[model samples]
Target chain A: MKKIINEPGKFVDEMVQGILLAHPGALRTVGDDLRILARADAPVSGKVGIVTGGGSGHLPLFKGYVGPGLCSAVAIGNVFSSPSSQQVFEATKAVDGGAGVLYLYGNYGGDVLNFDLACDLAELEDIETRTVLGRDDVASQPRERADDRRGVAGIFFAYKAAGAAAERGDSLDEVARIAEDVVVNTATMGIGISPTILPTTGKASFDLPDGEMEIGIGIHGEPGIHRGPLETADQIADRLVGAIIDDLSLADGDRVAVLVNGLGATPLEELYVLYRRVDEVLRGRGVEIERTYVGEYATSLEMAGASVSVLRLDDARLELLNAPAQSPFFREVSA
Target chain B: MRTADLNVVARRALADLVGYADELRDLDQALGDGDLGVTISLGAGAVIEALEQLPEDATAAELAKACAKAFANANPSTMAALVAGGLLAGSKTLVDSTEPNQADAARFVRAAGDNIALRGKTQLGDKTILDAIMPAADALEAGSDPVAALDAAVVGAERAVADTKALQSRRGRASWLQERSIGLQDPGATAFLRLLQCWQAALHAAPAERN
Candidate 1:
C-alpha cells in the first residue's frame, strides 16, 4: 500500500512517460496512441523484427527488452493485463522490416488471443508475422502438458536466442525456430516467501502466512504446488533448481546456462546465496555451468522471491547466449 | 429491432457494465489480479461514448464494429480483449442486415462464443467466459421471439455462472491457482452473465418506454 504514485489509475501512463524520458536515446513511442515502444533504430531494413508484449507491472520485461540485439518493439498493456490487439498491431507495423516480424511472448490466453488478432490485422497490411510462445515455467504444468505451462523468468533465454538470430540477419523462420528451441530446452521453477500488492487494489494479490513458503509459485501470485513452513535457503534452492533440473532431464557432461532471477524485492545478496547452492548442486551432478545470470531479470512488482531457470545448451545456443546484446535491463557485453 | 434501437440497447448495456465494476473487481480479487472491474468499466465507458457518436443510420454490423474498436482502445486487459474479439466475431454475422431479429441475435451470440473459444484455446469446462456465453448462445438459438430468446439466454448464463464454482480454471490468470481456484465463481463467466442480463433488460424495457 505504501508506494510513490500520484494516482493508481495513471500509474502505467506516468511510469511509461518516465521510462521514455530516462531512455530518450534508446527508446521512443510509436503510433499516434503511443501504446507501442520501439527502439530508436527500429525497422532496421532487412533484419527480422522481434516483438514481445504483456501486462505492465512486470517491469524490464516486454519494455525493458526493447533495444538493439533484443526486441525491436513492445506493445504496452495495463498492469498484469494483456495489450489490446490494436496496440499489438501498431507494434507490428512499427517494427516490420522486409524480412517479416517475429512475435515472441509468454503463452498466456489474453496475450495469445490479442496477439493472434494483431497478426490477422498485420497480414492484411502485407506484413508477415510468426509467433513463438514461451512456456518454460516447469511449476505451472506437468511435462506431459508443457505447452500449458506459464512463461516465467526463463523467457530471457528465448529473447537472447531469437534476438541474436535476427541480429545476425537470419530469416524470420530461423529466428522463430531458434526462439522455440530455447523454449523447448529451458525449464524454470520458483518459490514465493510472500505475496506482492497490486498497485490499483492496494492489496496483496494473494496471502501467504508468515513463516511459510509456497513452491512452484508463479510471478503473478498464482497458486503454487505446495505450501509449508519456511525452510533454509539451501533447501529452497534445492527445491527450485531440483525441479528445473529434473524437468530438463539434464545429465552429466551437459552444459547449461543458469538464471537466478529475483522476483522484484529479493536482494542481490540473497539471489547469490541461492545461486551458490544451485551451482553446487549442478556441479555435483557434473553439469557444466557455461554462463550464469543473477539479478532481477523478471519481476512481479515487489514480490519477495526468486526463481531458478536452467537452459540445456548446445554449441549454437551457447554462442547465441554469449552474443553481444544491449537493453536497459539486460546486457551481455561482448567478451 | 433496427440499428438505431440497437445503439440504445448497446449504450444501456455498457452503462450497466460500468455499474457492476466494483462487484466484478471483488470477484476477480479472489483468484485473479483484481483489475477486471476497473478495466471493464473503462472499456464500457469508452463504448458508451462511441455509441453516442454513432450515426443514426448505422447498420447492425457497423454498430458492433464501433463497440469493438472503442472497447479495444480504452483498455488492454484480457477480458476486454476477449469481449472485443467477441464483438468483432458477432459483427461479422450481422453484416448485410440493417434490422436484426431473434435469428440474427442467435447467430451473433453463437459466433461470438465460438470465436472466444477458438481464440482463447479453451473449452466449455475450462471455467472461463465461454462457460456462460456458450450455453447462452445455445438457448438463444432455440428460442423464438427476440425478448424470449434473450430471456432464455440469461437463464442459461445464470446457470453457467453458478456452475463455474465447481469447475477448475484452465485459462487466463485463474489457471495459475490450480485446485485452489475451485469454489470461487470465475470472474470472467460472471462478467459474461452480467452483460447478457443487461442486454436482456434493455431489450425488454425498450418496448414499454416507447409505448
Candidate 2:
C-alpha cells in the first residue's frame, strides 16, 4: 500500500521501536522481542511480578496495564494472536524477583498453549510461576462452562485488583487467587454493528446486513448467535445487558462495577447512549452500580461494536478495585 | 512444470507474493486499515527466514513445515496463523509419495480453503477469499497446467473480489458496512489473486530452465 513504511515485514518492529523511543522513561523493550514491554525499574523486589499477554491492536489492555500497581510485564502478540512461548518466557524471567511471577492472560487456545509452554520454560529457569486466565465474556460461552468464555475488557478490573494486591505485598499465590476471584465474579456481553479487518488480510472477518447488528459475537469476528434489524441504542443495551443478567445469575441486592467499552470505532455519543440504558436496567433490577467506566477501554482494530462488563463486587473486592493506582492507560481512586 | 524444483518455485512465490501484499495494502486502505501489506509481508518474511533454517536436502514437505512453524512463531496474528494453517495443509500434499500425479497442486488449493474455514470460520458466497479459492481449486483438480491453474485461480479470486461489492460481507471490518460495502473489492480476495499471479509466473518459468 502507499504508506510510509521502510518495509512491510518490519512494521511491528518499527512500531515497537517507536513506542520504546517515545516512552523511554516508562517502558523498555525486552531484548529484540517487541511484544514484551517491561517497566523502567523492573524486577521490583518483594513485589509479586504481575504479567499479562494478549494479541496486539487492543493497546493498553495487556501493555497499558503495565506500570506501577499493575502488570510489571506485558507480552503482546500480533493482532488477535498470542505471543510466542519464548517471548512470554523471556518476559517472565525479566520481571521475576525473589517473590515469584504470575502469568495472567486470556483463555484462548493459542494463548493457553504458548503460556503453558512459557511456564514450563520458566520452571526450568527456577522461576516459580502461577497462571490466571480471564474468561469473562459471558456472551461467548455459558456460565456453567465459563472457561469457554472469552476474555474481554472486563479484564481491566482483574488487573486493577490483582495489581493493587500485588503492589501491597501479596504473594504470588495471593495475587493469583485475587485474579481468579475477579474472573469468577465477572460477566460480559458484546454487540457488533461492523466487523474489522485483520491488517494482513485486508478483509472483514464477519458480516452483518445493513441496518442490522449481531448479538454475542466473538472478538475474532466469529459468527454471532443471531442477527436482526438494527435496534435503538436502548434496545441494543437491553439485549446485551439482558444476556449478562441471565448469564451471571445476578439477583436483587447485588453490587457490581460496570464498564461499557467501545470496540475501536464506536463514537462516544453512542457509548453514552448504551450506558444510559445499561444504568437504567441495572437500577430496575435493584443491582447496585458500585463503579462505572465508559470509554474505548479495549477494542478490536476499528471494529464498530461495544461490550458490557459487570464485575460483581464485595466489600474487599471493592476496596482493592478502588485502591490508588497509576498507569498510562488507567487510573484508580484511592480507598 | 514436471521438472521444476518445487522449493525454488515456492520461495519465489512467497517473495513475490509479499511484494503483492505491499501493493494490495494501498488498495485495502480505501476500505480497510492499512494492514494487508504489513500483515502479509510479515508472514511472508517469516516464511522466507524459516526456509533459510531448513536442511540443505530438505524436501518440499519439510520446507512447508518450517514455513508454517516460523510464520506462527513470528507473527501470531489470526491472519498469519490462518495462512500458516494453509501452508501446513499444503505441506502434507508435498510429502505424499503416491498422489493422483497432480495432487500437489490440488492439495494446495484444498489446504488453503481448509485454513480459511478453520481460522476465519467463513464459507463461500460470503464475499470472502473462498469465493476465488474454491472455484480455482475445482478447475485445478480437473488437471489444468500449473500456470493456467493459477491464472484461473487469479481470475476466480478477481471475480470474487468484484462480486464482494454486491454481496454483504460475512466477515472482517467490511461486514459492518452492509450494502454500503458496494464498490469495494474484498481486500483478502484481492491479495489472494495477487499471490496466485506471482505463483503462476514462478511455476511457468521453472519448466523452461529445467530443459
* Per-model root-mean-square deviation over C-alphas: 7.8, 11.5
What would the per-residue lDDT of candidate 1 be over residues B85-193, giving only the tens digit for each residue?
7788898899878899888988998898887888778899999989998888888889877677788889999999999999989897898999999999989889889
For each candidate, the alpha-carbon lDDT, in order, equals 0.87, 0.77
Instruction: Please state the error at residue A229 of candidate 2 in Å.
Output: 1.3
lDDT of 2 by residue, A1-335 (tens): 23355754566567678877777788777886777888777889888898788887676677778888788899887878888777887798888878899988878877876676566446545589999998998877777788887888888888989988988999999999999999988888888899877666666877777888888876677667788888899988998899888877878999999999998889998999999999999989999999999998778877788889999999989988888877667777575
Model 1: residues >4 Å from true position, as ranges?
A32-34, B1-117, B120-211
Q: Please, what are the lDDT tens digits per residue for candidate 1 over residues A258-334?
A: 99999999999999999999999999999999999999888999899999999999999999999999987778888
For each candidate in turn, the TM-score is: 0.69, 0.61
Positional deviation of residue A83's Cα in model 2 after best superposition, in angstroms: 1.0
Best by lDDT: 1
In candidate 1, how many Å is residue A289 off? 0.5
Candidate 2 chain A: worst-modelled 10 consecutive residues by lDDT = A1-10
